[model samples]
Target: MTQPLPTRDTIVDFIEGIFLRRGAESYLGEAVSMAQHMLQAAACAERDGAPAAMVAAALLHDLGHYTNEMPDDVLMEGTNNYHEEAGANFLARFFPAEVVEPIRQHVATKRYLCAVDPAYFQRLSDASVYTLELQGGPMSGAEVAAFRANPYLEACVRVRHWDDEGKDPERAHPPFSHYRPLLASLVTS
Candidate 1:
């Protein structure tokens, strides 16, 4: 009996709330904070001339990480919180499928990339590789084949690329307020 997030402003405020408080906190084991990572991703998407839907997805791709009260130490303790599913489910109530689907599949996109491209695995950061192992490692042949068949697979991969490259603590990017209009337009009643 889960409900989708409320109005677009509520949803946007929820995101802003997280960023205002926990934004400065370390992003799990990554160098940048959570807010920085998300901002970087969103900025990257915009720079690449992505659609508004995808830019929104990139901005909120890791919403799962904040959906619950789970301890951040869970990752250190070797736990997979499945934040992707949590985020997509929560966002589904307020956003179109285009925005939500990419968030849901970003993790799988990582595995899919790892499966199809050996070089891809080598490019991951140490923290990413660690989480990849915790996330069931690379995709198997069957998993890769199934992943390939998904229509939103490309979207997921695009977000994944931004997610991977968005971890720089020193990276310069605009503030979260820059995306407010984009997020507001996509918000449902």
Candidate 2:
């Protein structure tokens, strides 16, 4: 039989365990580990004076990477893992839409940025560039317009920017415990 799901009180710990167990893995060949990347993203959001929910979204934006079943190189092998949707779906169970919507839209924001800002595409890391092709290689005019209509567009872009900056190997980041209380405050259930 399957194990019982974690209750609201225990869900935070369950998430923490995921970090402890898997965060040390490489982040798609980036210089930082997955946990470090996430923590740095949270740090960037927090440093920029973002609201609590946006900071949380940045912290957990790539959570689908952790939760997805595929190998880390799945994107390199030319597959759109759709980790953004998976992460947002998982987070929606416990987080409010304010926190979850941005996570869901973060990937699309990448494509959107590429379409609107040529420099943005130039800034993407090699792995991100590779994944971009699999992610449909930027938005068309109609796609850009539709993305601009999203209520969470600004928040999603903020998270995406943090995601871009979070991969710096030299950046120092706080421990996950630093944000545990923030996570607890945002839990919906």
Best by lDDT: 2
**After best superposition, candidate 2 residue 165: deviation in angstroms?**
0.3
Best by TM-score: 2
Q: Mind giving the per-residue lDDT tens digits that candidate 1 earns over 86-188?
A: 7777777788988999998888899889989999899998999999987888899999989889888878889899989899888898998899889889987
lDDT of each: 0.82, 0.85
Q: Which stretches of candidate 2 lie over 4 Å from their true place?
A: 1-3, 68-81
For model 2, the local distance difference test gives 0.85
**lDDT (10s digit) by residue, model 2, range 1-189:** 122445679767877877788899999868999999999999999999999999999988888876443233433333344788767776777889999999988878999999999999999999899988988899999999999999998898899999999999999989999999999999995
Q: What is the lDDT for 148 in model 1?
A: 85
Q: What is candidate 1's CA lDDT for residue 121? A: 91
Worst 10 residues of 1 by lDDT: 69-78
Scanning candidate 2 in windows of ten residues, the lowest lDDT window is 69-78
Cα RMSD (angstroms) for every candidate in the order listed: 4.8, 4.6
lDDT of 1 at 77: 35
- Using all chains and alpha carbons, the TM-scores for the candidates as numbered come to 0.88, 0.90
